[model samples]
Target chain A: MSHPAKHRPLIALVALFGLCLSVPAFAQFDAEAAENTFKDNDCHKCHHATKAKKGPALKKIAAKYKEKKLDEKEAIKHMTAGQKVKLDDGKEEDHKIIDTKDVKVQTNVARWMLSH
Target chain B: MDQRALILGFSMLAFGSAMAADPASIDWGKIPATKLTLFYPGQSSYEWLRSEGHKGASSETARGDSCVSCHDDAKEEQRQGAKILRGNHPLEPTTIAGKKNGHVDLSVQAAFDAKNAYLRYQWKTQNPFPGNEHQYLRFDGKEWKVYGFPKLDKVVQEGKQPGIYEDRMSIIIDDGKVPGFAKQGCWLTCHDGQRDMPKQFTKEEVAANALLTAIKKNDVRKYLPDTRTNPSDWKTGKSVEDIAKLKEAGAFVELIQWRAHRSHAVGMADDGYVLEWRLADAGKDMFSGNADSKTHQPKFMWDEKKVGYKSITADQLRKGDHFLIREQNAVPFDPNAGWKEGDMIPDYVTSREDAKGSAADNNAIANWKDGMWTVVVVRPLGLANSDDKALKAGGVYNVGFAVHDDNITTRGHFVSYVKTLGLGAKADIQAVKLP
Candidate 1:
C-alpha cells in the first residue's frame, strides 16, 4: 500500500474533499425527527442514550452491532421484528416494535440509534 | 293517629334519621357499574411518571395531562399491565414465577342515600384460593420468627420465607383538593425512596430524613408531593407545620383500605390520609401489629376453645379462614401453652371495638365466592372530620382504586388511573341517588 511521497498530499486533499461532500448526505437524516419518533413510540422507557435502564443503552447497542459487523438492515429488522430481547435484568420479553411501517422513518431511527 | 301507628311512625323517623344506610338494602342491580381494568403498576411512581425515562408521556405529564388523556383507549390498562407483568420490563424488576394475569376487571357500582355512600367492588382473584392469610409468627424449632412475606421482599426472593400476604382493596379520594390528583392520581403519592419502588431508600437515608425523624417513622410510604420541597425527593420534605397547614386546607388524599385478613373479620376498613406520610387518621385503626415490640413473640393467639386450635401450622395456610380477630377468636398469647416447633400465629390482630375517631369512620363487608371478591364499602356522607374527604352528594371527587391480590402487598398491587366519581352529579362514574 505504499504511495509516492509527491502523491500523498494530493490523496489527503481528495479524501478531505470527499468527506466534505458526504457531510450533507449524513446530515440529511434528521436527528430531531428521529428522536421525536423514538419518544412518540415511548422507546426511551427502556432504552437510554448513555445509561442502561431496562434495555441496553443506545451506545452499547451501537457498539455491539458495530463490533458484530452488523449493518442498518439488522437494526431495522430488530425494530420491526419484535423479536424476544434479553433485557439488562436477565429477563426475556418481546422487544417493542417501532410504531411505524414507513421504511424511511424506520431507517432514520435505526441509523440514529446506530450513530450513538 | 292510633297509639300503635304513632309508635310505628316514631320508629320509622328514628330509623331514617339515626341508622346508617345498609349496603344490602341498596339495589345494586339497578345502579350502573363502571367497569375499570385495574392493572399492576409495579414501580411506576410519581417520579417515574414525570422523568425522562417515561419518554412520550413525560412531557404530557409535566404539562398536567391526565394519565387517561393519552392512554384513553379502553384496553390501555390491560396493554400496560401485560407488558409490565411479563417482568423485567422497565416498570417491573422482580418477577413472580407463578403470577399470571396482568390485569383484573373491577366492576364498581356506587349508590348514595341521605347519610352514606355505598361503593361496591367486584373482581376475580388471580389465585383459586382467596388471599386471607397475611404474615405469620412461626416457631422454627425453638424461637419464634417472622415467616411469609410479599413476593417483592428480598426474603421471599431468596427463598428464606414463603410468599404470604393478604388481599386488599384501597381507595384514594380527593375532593377537588390536592393539586395534580385529578391528572396524576395515585402517582402523586407514589415516588422514589418508597418501599419496593425505584431508588428505594436506604436505612441510613431514611434515618437521616428530617421529616421521617420528626414523625418517628422508620420507613417511607405513600406521601403527597406537596409535602416535599422537591416534589420528587422523599428526603426533601417540608416542615411538619407546613404539612399541618396543608391538612388544614384539606389538601390531602384520603386513603381507605379494606384488608382481607386485618379488617374484613372486624367488618371495617382502615382510614388514613397521605400528606407527609401514609398516616392513620386522628386515632387508632382497627388493626395493629400482633407481635410484641420487645419480645418479638405474638401478643395474641387464636383461642383454642373458640377456634379449636391455639395456633396454625404451615400446612394450614389457605385451607380455611386464618384471621386472628381479637373480639371473636384471639386471646392473649400464653407463652407456656404447649409450645411446638410447627406452630404459626397471625402477624396482625383486628378489633372493631379498638378503633376510634376518624380512623374508624369507614365500614365494609366482603364475601368471596366462585373465585371472585364482592366487597361493599360504606362511607359516611357529609363528614366534617379533618381527616376525611367528606363524600357528600352533588359533589364530584377524583378517585383512584387499587387491589392487592394473590398474596402480595406494597407496590405489588393492581391500580387504576384517576376517575371522577360524582355522587348525585355528572362525572366519570356517577353515583345514583337512592329512592
Candidate 2:
C-alpha cells in the first residue's frame, strides 16, 4: 500500500499542515498579560506554578480540566463566579472572584492557567 | 428621709466601699459588653501580614491600614479562622485533631473606680472541661523527665506525649505612644523568627545573633519592630541604649496575662511589656518553675495532709485542681516518699507573697462553670512605673486581645484586631466611671 514517490511528498506536506492547524490556540495566548492579571488579583497567594499552597498548583488544575475534556470556558467561569470550592485542607470557602469584567482579559488568563 | 430612701442610701454606701476594694463586686449588668470575635491566627506573623502571600491586602497593610478596615464584616473572623484551622492550610502547617472550633466569642466589659480599672471578660471553652492543667514532671523507672506538652508541640503530634497546657487570656495595651500600634495591633510585636511562626529561628542562628547574645537571650519571643533597624528582620536590632531610650519614652506595649494554672491560684496576672523582647517587669512574677534545674526533680510537692496526694497519676488530669501554691498547699519535695514511676507533679508553682514591685500590680479573679470562663482583671489606675502604661482617667489607648485554649500555646491562640479603649472618654470600649 505504498504511494508513489511524487505523491508521498504531497501527502507528507498535507499531514504537516494538518498537524499545525490541530494545535490548540492556548499555545499562542498572551502569557505575560495573563500573569500580570493573576498577580494583580493576588491569585498567586494560593496558587503556584507546580507547587500547591492554599490552592492547587496550576499544573494540577490544568491536568484536571483536561482529563474532564473541559476547556477555557469552565476556567473562566471559575474565575468570574464566586462559587464554593473545597480546598486541600478539607474546608469549603467561596472562591475569590477575579478583578476584571473584560471577556478578553478573562479568556487570556483562563487559557494561560490551562496551558500550565 | 423616708424609710425606703434610708435603706437605698445605706446600700449605695456599702456598694461603693466594696467596689473600691474588689472589682468582682462591680455591677456588671450596668456595664455594656463589647462583643469581639477572636479567631485562630496560626502562623500568620507580622511578616506574613505584609508579604505578597497575604493577597490583595498586603499593600494596604504596609501603608498602615488597620486589620479591621478590610476584614470588617461580622462573619469575617469566623471565615478566616475556619479556613486556617483546617489541615494543610497555608497558615497552618500542623493541625491538632481534637480542635474543632475556629473562633470564640469574647464578651468584654470595662469600668473604672477611683482606685482601679476593672476589665471583665467571658468566653466559652472549646472543651467541656476547663483547661486548668499545665505541663508536669513525670517519673520514669530511673529519673524524672518532662511530660505533657502543648498540642502543637512535636512530641504531642508524634503521640510520644499527651497534650496538656493551660488556658490564658492576655491583653496588650498601648497608650498612644508606640507608633503604628493603633493600626497594626499585636502583629507589630509578632515577627518572623518567633516560635511557631514563619522562618522560625534555629538554635544556631539564635546563638549567633548579635542582639540575642548581647541580651543573653537563647530564644526569640515577641518584640517590637522599632527595636530593630530593619523592622522585618529579627536579627537587626538596635543598641541596648537605644532600646532604653525607647522605654523611657514609653514606646512599649504592656502585656498582662492571666494564666489558668500559673497565676490564677494566687489571684494575680503576670505583668510584662514587649519592646526588644517580651520582658517581665522590674521585679518577680507570681509564678516560678517548680522543677529544680540541677537535679531535674520537682522542688515542691502537694501537701498530702491537705490535698491527700503527694503526686498525681495520668488519669487524674482535669479531675480537680492540681495547683501547688508555695504558701498554702505545697511542701518540700522529699526523695524517700515511696516514689513511683507513674507519679506526676506540676511544672510551675504559684506564690502571691513572692510577687513584688511592678510585676505584682495586676490582680485577677476567675471562675469556670458550665463550660465558660468569667474573669475580672483589676488594674490600678495612675501607675507611674517606667515598665507600665499609666492607665489614667479620660485616656484612650490602643488595645489588642488574645485567648489561648484547647491545650495549646504560642501561635495556637486566637487573636483580635486592634481596638480603641477609653478610660472615660468615648471610644470603642469605653470605661464608665463608677459612682
Candidate 3:
C-alpha cells in the first residue's frame, strides 16, 4: 500500500475545507467571525486571542475547555452580554458587555475560536 | 465640612501613645465584636449583573491574581476587600433569598428582613455608573422608594447600640414605627434583619418612635439623610431639604462573605463564617452627582431618573453571576479604612504572609503592618485531602483586632477571618492550586 503519510497534508486540507463549508443556515458565520468580533469590539482593550494579554489568553482558554470544538453560541452569550471565566489563576471576573443587540463583532470572534 | 473640621470636632484625637482619631483607636487587648455589620458591594450581585454586570471583563490571569491584583492594592490599589469586610459570603443557595427555599426555619424573621431590600430601596438607583446615581430609601410597605440611606452609621456606632443587632446582617424597625409605611406598624427592618411578627419590641418599642426607617421619618433626621443631588434626573433636580419632605427609593443589593478555618491548612474544622453584601452602590462621588469611569467614587445608592439611567430588573442583574465570593483573611476591627482615591496597596497574594501559613521572614508580595489593630490582609491556602484526593488554592484572608478598655468587660472581643472553600466542592478542590 502507498504510504499514507504522503497524503496526510491533503487530508488535513480537506478537513479544513469541510469546516469552512458548514456555515449555519440562519446567520452569516465563518471561522474568522470571532476575529472580526475581536476587532469590532476592540477586545484588544483588555484581551488577546491566544495569549494572556491584558486579560487571559485565548489559547489558554482553549486548553481550559474540554470540549474539542469551541461553541460560538456560548462564546457569543458571554461576549455580547458577559460571562464568568476562571483563569488559570483562581480569581474571578464578569465578562459582561455594554450592548447585546447586533453584537456581530462578538459572534465573529466566537466563529474564529471555533475553527481554531 | 472638610475632614479637618470633623477631626477638630473632637480633641486632638489620641489612641494609646500613637496620636490618633480617638481613644477607641487604640488596640488594648480586645473589644466586643458587638456592633459590626458586613457591607457587601451591592454592585457585585445578581441585580447588578443585569445592569452593569456585562461590562469590564477580567480573569484570574496571574495564575491566582485576578481580584487581588486590582483590589488588594494597599500600596496603590489598596486591595482592601478582605480588610474592610467581615469575611466573604459564598453563594450557598441557603444564604440567598428566593434562590432556594433552603435550609432553615427562622426564615419568617429572615423573610421579614428581606436581605437586600434596604439597599434596593435606599441606595441603588437606575444608573450605577457615570456619577453613578445616589439616593435614599423610604419604604411605605407597598413600595420601597429610591432614597438615601442613613449615613448615621458612625453616629449609631458612636451612640448606644440603640439596642440594635449591630453585629449581624439586618436592622430591625419596631412596630407602629415603620418609616414610609407607618401603617405597616412599628418594625422598620433595614439592611439587616431587625424585626419579625411576634417578636415585636416590648419596652423598647414604646420608648423610641423612629424605626431606622427613611431619614424623613426619623424625627431628628440627624443621620445620613438624602440630599437631592440627582444630577441625572432630567425632569427635576432638587437640593437637600427635610428628610421626610422628599421620598425616593429603589431595589439593589450585594453582600460580602467570610470563611474561617481552624489551622492554616486548606481544609480544617467547624470554623464559623460571615458575609456582608451591598444592597446598592448608592453613594456616588458626592462632588459630582454622576459617576465617570475616570472619576469613580464608591457610593452605595442613587436614583435612576435623576441619573438618566433606566431601571434594571433583578433577573437581568442575576444573569451576570455577580455572586462569586472572594475569600480573604478577615481583617480585625482595631482599624477600618478603604483603598483611597489615589492610594496603592500591595496584594497579599503577591505581598505578605500570615503568621500561621506563611514563611517566617515574611515575603508574599505584601503584609499588613502589624502595628495597630486596623484591618489588615493575610493569606491562607485552601484545600482538601481524602483517600488519594487533595485540593489547594490561595485564599486571601483578613483578621481584625479590637481593644477592650479594662472597664469594657473581660470577654475581649475579637474577629479573625479565614478562608473556607465551603461545603459543596470538597472533592474537586483537592487538585486546584492558586498561583
Candidate 3's C-alpha runs over 4 A off are: A1-57, A60-103, A111-116, B1-10, B13-40, B43-435
Name the 10 consecutive residues with the lowest summed lDDT in model 2 chain B. Answer: B1-10
TM-score of each candidate? Answer: 0.78, 0.78, 0.21
Residue A60 shift from truth in candidate 1, angstroms: 36
- Steric clash pairs (candidate 2): none
Instruction: List model 2 lDDT by residue over B299-326, tens digit each.
Output: 9998888768889999888887778778
Q: Chain B in candidate 2 has what TM-score?
A: 0.95
Ranking by lDDT: 2, 1, 3
Candidate 2 local lDDT, A1-116, one digit each (tens): 98989798899999999998999866668998998788656677667788776578899999999899889989999988989888655767778899789999999999999999
Give per-residue lDDT, candidate 2, residue B280: 93
Error of model 1, residue B254, in angstroms: 0.7
What tens-digit string does per-residue lDDT give for candidate 3 at B60-166? Answer: 22122232222221121111222222233221111111111111111100000111100000111111211111221222233333322112223333442111110
Worst 10 residues of 3 chain A by lDDT: A33-42
What docking grade applies to model 2?
Answer: incorrect
Residue runs of model 1 more than 4 Å from their true location after superposition: A1-116, B1-18
Q: How high is the TM-score of chain A in each model? A: 0.77, 0.83, 0.51
